[model samples]
Target chain A: MNLIIGNDITIGYEGEPVVSHLTFSVESGDYICIVGENGSGKSTFVKSVLGLIPPLSGKIVFSGGLRQDSIGYLPQRSAIQQDFPSSVTEIVLSGCLNRHHRLFGYSREEKARCRTMLERLGIAGLSSLSFQELSGGQQQRVLLARAMMATERLLLLDEPATGLDPQATAELYSMIDSLNGSGITVMMVTHDIHPALNAAGKILHFSHDGYFFGPKDEYFKSEKGMTFMKEAGHDHH
Target chain B: MIITEILSYPFLSRALFVGFLISISSSLLGVSLVLRRYSMIGDGLSHVGFGALGIASLLSLSPLYVTLPVVVVSAFLLLRLSQRKGGGDSAIALLSSSALAIGVAAVSIGGVNTDLNAFLFGSILSVSRSDALISLAVSLVTLSAYLVFYHQIYATTFDPAFAKATGLRCERYNNLLALLTALVIVVGMRMLGSMLISSLLIFPSLSAMKVARTYFRVSVIAAAESVAAFLAGFIASYALSLPTGASIVIAHMLIFIILSASGLIIRRIHSVIS
Candidate 1:
C-alpha cells in the first residue's frame, strides 16, 4: 500500500522554486534513495515531505493511516547539534515528546520503549553517557534510536552519513538496510549513494536539468540514471 | 557577625529574598539559552530594560510597568530576528547599542542623574515594598512556567528542527521561553541592575556546565551556584561598603574560577590514575 504520495510538487524556500515538477509515492517497506549534487533541492524535497517546509505548488498526501507528525526524522548533524548537553537516554526518549496528547511526563511504557530502542540499537550501555562524548558512529546510532522512538513506520533521513568514516558509513547503511527489511519505509537523501544504492528499491534523482523517480530496476535502464552512474563512477546491476 | 545585624533590617531582608528568587529564575532559564547560543539575548534585553526605565523615570511612572512590556517586546523582536538567516550576533549588537543610546539620552534629557546610579548599578535599599512584591510574584510565575514546559524546552533547545518535525511547536515554546526570560530580566534588574543582570544568567550556567554532564543536573547546580554567589556578593558588598552589582558580579566570577580550577584538578587526577 502507498504510505505517502507526492504529486506535482515544487520544493523551494521563500516562494522561489529550487526544484520543480516532482512526483513520487512511497509504498510500505520500500526504500527510496534521493540522490543529487549540491543545491539540487534534495534536502528541500525531504523537508517538504517531512512537513518541515511547505511545498510551493503541489500536495503531499499521507495515506494508510499516517498522522501529520508520524514520520521519524534524522537530520544532518551540525556542530551545534553535536555539542548538545544531553544524555543518550534523554535524547532518545525525547522522540516521544509529541507522540502523546498529554503534556505531562512520559509513561512507564514510554520509558520501556526507550530502553528497548537503545538495546536494539546496541547502545544500551551508553544510555547514561553524554551524547557528545560518543564517537561519530555511536552518535548516529543514538540518533537513529531516537528517531525510532518517534515512529516505527516511516523514517526520513537527510544525509545520515555526512561526516562519518568509511567503516561507520558501512555500519549505518547496514543498520538502515536491516530496518527496511523489517517492514519500515525509508526515504533517505545522500550524495554518497554507491554503497546504499543496492538497498534502495526506488531512486529519486534530482538534477540540474530536471528530476527522475521510479523503481530501481527501471532507473538502472533509464538515460538519466545511466548518466548519473557514469558520472559518479558507480556500477549498478 | 555584621551580617546578622544587617539581615535584621527589613530592607536588607527584602533584598535577600528578592535576590534569591531572581537568582533561581535566571539560572533555571540560563541553561537552555546558553546551549542555544542565545545567551546574549539576556544582556540585550537588559539594555532595553534600561531604556524603558529611563522613560518611566522621565514620566514619573512605575518602572516595572513600563520596563516589563518593553523588555518583553524586545525579547520577542530578538527572537524573530534570530530566526531569520544571517541575523544572529550582529542583530543583538545593533539592538543592544541602540537601546543603550536611547537610555543614556533619556537620562541626560530628563535630568534623572540623582537616580542614575541606582538604575545602572542597582541599590538594594532603594527597592520599595511594592517592587519587592512584584519581583516575588514574577519570579514565581517564571519558575512555574519553566517547570510546566521543561520537556518541550529540552527538546527544542537541543534540536529545534527535529523537535518541529515531531509536531512540537518549537517556535511557540521559544517565544514562551523569551517571555519568561524577559520577566526574569526585568525583576532581576531591580537588584542586579541593568549593567550586571546578564551575569546572573551567564555565570551560573557556564560554571555548572564545567562540572555537570547532563542538562537536568546542570540546571539544578546552576541555580544553587547562582543563589550562593548572590548571597556572598550581597554580604560582601554590605560588609565592605562596595557597589552591590560589582560586588555580586565579582563573587560570581570568583566562584566560576574556583569551579573551573576544581574541574581541572579532578581531570588531572583521573588522568594520572589511569
Candidate 2:
C-alpha cells in the first residue's frame, strides 16, 4: 500500500521553485534512498514532508493509516547536540512523547518499551550515561533507538551517518536494513551512494540537472541518475 | 540567632522570603534558558521591565501592573526574533538599549524622586510586603507550569525537531517558557535589580551542569544551589553590611568556581584510575 503520495509537488526556498512539480509515492515496507547535492532542496523537501514547511504547490497525502506524527524521524545532529547535557534514557524517552497523553511525565508502560528499545539497539547500559560522553557511533545508535520509539511503522532519517567512522556507518546501515526487513518503510537521505544503493529499493536523486525518482535499476537507467552516479563515482575514486 | 534577627526586622524577612521564591523559578527556568542559549532573554526582559517601571512610577501606578505585561510582550517578541534563523544578540541589544534609554529619559524627566539606582542594582533590603506577596504568587504559577509541562519542556529543549514531529506544539511550550521567565524577571527585578537578576538565571544552571550529567540532575541541583546561595548571601549581606544583590551574585560566583574545580578534579581522578 502507498503510505505517502505526493502529486506534482514543488519544494523550494523563498517561492523560487527549485525542485519543481515532482510526483512520487512511497509504498509500505519499501526502502527509498534520497541522494542529492547540498543545495538541491533536499532538506526543504524533507521539512515539507514532515509538515514543518509547506510545499510551494501541491499537497502531500499520508494514507494507509500513517499520521504525520507517527513517522519516526532522525534528523542530522546539530552543534547544540554535541555538548548537550542529557542522559541516553532521557533522550530515548523523549521519543515516546508523542504517544504520551497524560501530564507530568512518562507512563510505566512507556518506560518499559523504551528499556526494551535500548536493549534492542544494544545501548541499555549506556542509558544512564550522559549523551555527551558517548562516541559518535554510540550516539547515532541511541538516536536510532529514540526515533524507533516514535513509530515502528516508518522511519525517516536525514543523513544519519554524517559523522560516524566506516565501521559504525556500516553497522547503522545494517541496523536500518534489518528494521526495514521487519516491515517498516525506510526513507533515508544520504550523500554516500554505494552503501545506500545496496540497501535502498528505490532511489530519489535530486540534482542541479533535475530530479529523478524510481526503482534502483530504473534510477540507474535515468539520465540525471546516470550522470550523478558517474560524478559521485569519480569523486569517491 | 539569625532567625531571631530575621523575625525582628520586617525588611530582612521580606528580602529572604522574596529572594528564595524568585531563586526557585529563576534556577528552574534557567536550566532551559541556558541550555538553549537564551540566557540573555532574562537580561533583555529585565531591562524592558525596568523601562516599564520608569513609566509606571511617572504615571503613579503600581510597577508590577506596568512592567509585567510590557516585559512579557518583549519576551514573546524576542522569541519570535530568535526563531528567524540566527542573530538573537542583535535583536536583544536593540530592544534592551532602546528600552533602557526610554527608562532613563522617563525617570529623569518626571520621576527623579524615585531612586533609579535601586531599580538598576536591586535593593533586597528594601523588599516590601506587597512585593513579597507578588513574588510568592508568580513563583507558584511558574513552578506549577514547569511541573505540569515538565516532559514537554524537556523534549522541546533536548530536540525541538523531534518534538515538533511528534505533534507537540513547541511554540506553545516556548511561549510558556517565555511567559514564565517574564513573570519571574519582573518579580525578581524588584529586589535583584535589572542588572543582577540575569546572574540568578545563568550561574546556578551552568554550575549544576558542571557536576550533573543528566538534565534532571542539572535542574534539581540548580534549584538547590540557587536557593542555598540566596540564603547564604541574604544572611551574609546583613552580617557584613554588604549589598544583598552583589553578595548573592558573589555567592553564585563562588559556588560556580568551586563546582567547576571539583568537576576538573573528578575528571582527573577518573583518567588516572581508568
Candidate 3:
C-alpha cells in the first residue's frame, strides 16, 4: 500500500498556513525521514498526514489497500504526560481498542499481541510497572511497543529521539531499522538529521517557506541541502 | 453515641443514601476532571448551581427540577465557551460570578423567607426522599454512560491526536463529559452544598493518585476515599453540630494531606532501598 499526496496543501490554524504547497508520496516499505529546524512545520506536516490537522487545500489519497486500522503512529515522546497513571500493559492494550474486540474488554488475542510486542521491544518485564515510573528511554520503548501493537504496515514517528541519550538513540534507531527491514513503511519527523539519514532511503526537508521530497542522495547533492548543512554547522561527509 | 443516634434517625438514613450515591458519581467524573486539570471547574459550576437553586426557591418552584436544567444548560454553555481560543478560564469565571450575583439579587428582590442556610452549608436532615431518588438515578445513568463509552473516553483523554487520526469523534465525548459533570453537580449539591461540592470532586482523586498505579486503581481508591470522607463527615457533623458541607470538605482535605505526605515518604524509602 502507498500514501499519495497531490497539488498544493496548506496546514495550520485559522490565520496563516504553516506549511503550504506540499506534495509527496510514500510507497510500502519506504523509510522516509523528515528533517528541518524548529518551527519549520515538521510536526505540522506529520499531523496533517495523520489527519490530526485538516488540510486547507489539495488531497491525500491512500492507495494500495491501506486500511486506517493498519496505520500506527508514535507521537513525540515529550507530547505525552509521563506522569499519567497507567501501566505499560494498559497503554499497549489501548492500541487495540479500534479492533472491535468486545465492550469494555480486550480479547485474548489482543492480550497476547500486547505481550508479544512488549517482548519484542524488550519491555516484557515492565508490563506491570507504572508507565510514569519508567526512565525516559524505557518510556519511549514502551510507547513504541504500544504503537506497534495493532499492525506493522505503516509507522509514523515524530522526534523519536529528542530526549534520549546518544546510546539510547542508537538503540532506538537500530529498532527502527529492524522494523523497516521487516517491510513496515516508516516516516519520521526529526530535527537531528545524521542518524535518520543512515536509515532513510528518502528525505523530506522542510524549511520556513517550503519543503522538498526526493531520494536522500539527491537531496544531499542539492544547493539548498548543502546550504542547510553549512548553516546547521554540520559537515555532511 | 452520635453514630448510634444518626443510624436511628430515618432522615439520617436518607442522607447517607444520598451521600453515597453522589460520592460515587462525583468520583467517576472526578477522574476525567483531574486528568484534564480542570478540577476547579467543579467549584465554579457548583457556585452557578447555587444561583439556580436560589432562583428556583424565589420563584416558588421545585429547586430540584429548576436547578437540574439550569445547571445542565450552564455546563453546556461553559463547554462551548471554553472551546474558543483564549476564553476558557475567563468564561468560567464570568459564568460563575454572574450566576452567583443573579441568584442573590433574585432572592433579595423576592423577599424570600426560606432558610437559605441549608442550601449553603448543607443539612443531612434536609435531604428528602425525592432528592434521594434523583441522586440514585443520576448515578445509574452516569455509570451506564461510562461503561458504554469507556474506550472512546480513554482514547480522547490520553491522546486527542491519535483519537482523531483513528476517526473517533472526540468533540462528542467532550460534550458527554460536560453533561455528566452537570448531572453530578446538581445531584451532589444536596449533600455537599454548592459552595463545597468541588472539594468532594477534587480531594479524593488527588489522594488516590498518591498511591494508585493505574487509572482503574485510581478510580477504586478515589471511590473508597470519598465514601470514607462521607461517613466521617456525617458522623462528625452529627456530633459537633457542624455544617455537613464543611465537615465533608474538612474530612477530604485531611485525607488529601495525609496521603500526599505518605506518598513522599514512600518515594524516599524506595530510593533509599534501591
Candidate 4:
C-alpha cells in the first residue's frame, strides 16, 4: 500500500519554487533514497513533505493510515544544535513529544521505550551524559533513537551523516539499513549516493537537469544516473 | 539571632517573600530563555516596564496595572518581530532604548518627585504587602506554567525546527514562554529593577550549567542557586546598607564564580583519575 503520494509538488522559500513538478509515492516497507546535488531543493522538498514548510502548489496525500504526526523525522543538525545543553536521555525522550495526548509529562512506558531505543542504538550507558559532549557518531545514533521514538511506521531523515568519518558513515548506514529491514518505510535525503543507493529500493533523484523516480536498478541504468555515478567515481578518484 | 530579629520586621518579611518568589520564577524560565537565545528579552521587556512605570508614576496611576499590560504587549511584539527578517538583537535594541528614553523623558518632563534611581536599581526593603502578594501570584503562575509545559518547552528549546516538524505547535509554546517571561520580569522589576532583572534570568542558569549536565538538573540547580543567592544577598544588603539589587547580583556572581572554579577542579580530578 502506498503510504505517501505527492503529486506535482512545488517546494521552495517565499513563493519562489526551487524544485517543481515533483511527483512520487512511497509504498509501505519501501526504502526511498532522495538524492540530489547541492541547492537542488532536496531539503526544501523534504521540509515541505514534513509539513515544516508549505507547498507552493500540489497535494501531499498521506494515505494507507499514515498521518502527518505519525511520521518520525530526523533533521540535519547544525553546529549550534549539536552544542545545545541537554542530556542524551533528555534528547531521546523529547522525541516522544508527538506520542503524547497531554502537553507535559511522559508515561512510564514512554520512559521505558526511550531507554529501549537508546539501548538499541548501543548508547544506553551514555543516557546521563551531556549530549554536547558526545562524539559525532554517537550523537547521530542518539538522534536516530530520538527519531525512532516518534514513529514506528515511516522514518524521514535529512542528511543524517553529513559530518562523519567514513567508518562512522558506514556504521550509520548499516543501522539505517537494519531499521529499513525491520519493516519501517525509510525516506532519506543524502548527498552521499553510494551506500544510500545500495540500500534503497527506490530512488527519487532531484536535479536541476531532471527528476528521476524509479527502482534503484533502473535508476543506475538511466542517463542521469550514469552521469551521477561517473561524477561520483571521479570525485572518489 | 540576627536572622530572627530581621524576620520580625514586616518590611524584611515582605522583601524576602517577594525576593524568593522572583528568584524561583526567574530561574524557572531562565533555562529556556538562555538556551533559546532570547535571554535579552528579559532585559528588553524590563526596560519597557520601566518606561511604563515612569509614565504611570507621572500620571498618578498604579505602576503595576500600567506596566503589566505594556510589558506583556511588548513581549508579544518582540516575539513576532524576531520571526521576521532581522537579527533579534536589533529589535531588542530598538524597543529597549526607545522605552528607556521615553521613561527618562517622562520622569524628567513631569518633574515627578519619586526616586527614579530606586526604580532603576530597586529597593527590596521598600516592598509593600500588596506588592508581595502580586509577586507571589505572578511567581506561582509562572512556575505552574513551566511545570505544565515542561516537556514541550524542552523539545522546543533544543530544536524548534524539529519540534515544528513533529507537529508540535512550537509557536504556541514560544508565546507561552514569552508571556511567562513578561510576567516574571514585570514582578521581578519591583525587586531586581530594570537594569539587573535579566541577571536573575541568566546567572543562575549559566552557573548551574557548569555543573549540571541535564536540562532538568540545570533547572533544579538554577532555581536553588537563585533563591539561595537572593536570600544571602537580601541579608547582606540589610547588614551593609547596600543596594538590594546590586547586592543580589553580587551574590549570584560570587556563587557563579565558586561553581565555575569547582567545575574546573572536578574536571581536572576526573582527568587525573582516568
B84-143 in candidate 4: lDDT tens per residue?
Answer: 766468878899999999888888877864658867988775588888888889889998
Cα lDDT, all candidates: 0.87, 0.87, 0.80, 0.87
Looking only at chain B, model 2 earns a TM-score of: 0.96
Q: Model 4: residues >4 Å from true position, as ranges?
A: A102-104, A234-237
Query: Model 4: clashing residue pairs?
Result: none
TM-score of candidate 2's A chain against the true A chain? 0.95
Q: After superposition, how far is residue B247 of candidate 3 from its true place, in Å?
A: 1.4
lDDT of 4 by residue, A39-120 (tens): 8878887888888788889988899998887678888866336556789988899898886767557888999999899988
What is the CAPRI rating of model 2's predicted complex?
medium
The alpha-carbon lDDT assigned to residue A165 of candidate 1 equals 98
Better of 1 and 3 by DockQ: 1
Candidate 3, residue B258: Cα displacement in angstroms equals 1.6
Scoring each candidate complex against the real one, what DockQ results? 0.65, 0.69, 0.56, 0.69
Better-scoring candidate (TM-score), 1 or 4:
4
Write the number of the candidate with greater TM-score, choosing between 1 and 3. 1
- Candidate 1, after superposition: displacement of residue B17 in Å? 1.0
lDDT of 1 by residue, B25-94 (tens): 9999999998887888888999999889888888888899999999999999998877778758788888
Q: Which one is best on DockQ?
A: 4
For B1-274, candidate 2 gives per-residue lDDT tens digits of 9867976887877777778889999999999998887887888888898899888877878888899889899999988877667747898889999999888888887757455887788886557788788889999999999988988998899889889977889999999999999999999987878888889999999999999999999999999999999988888888898878889999999999999999999999989999
* Poorest 10 consecutive residues by lDDT, candidate 2 chain A: A228-237
Sort candidate 4 into its docking category: medium
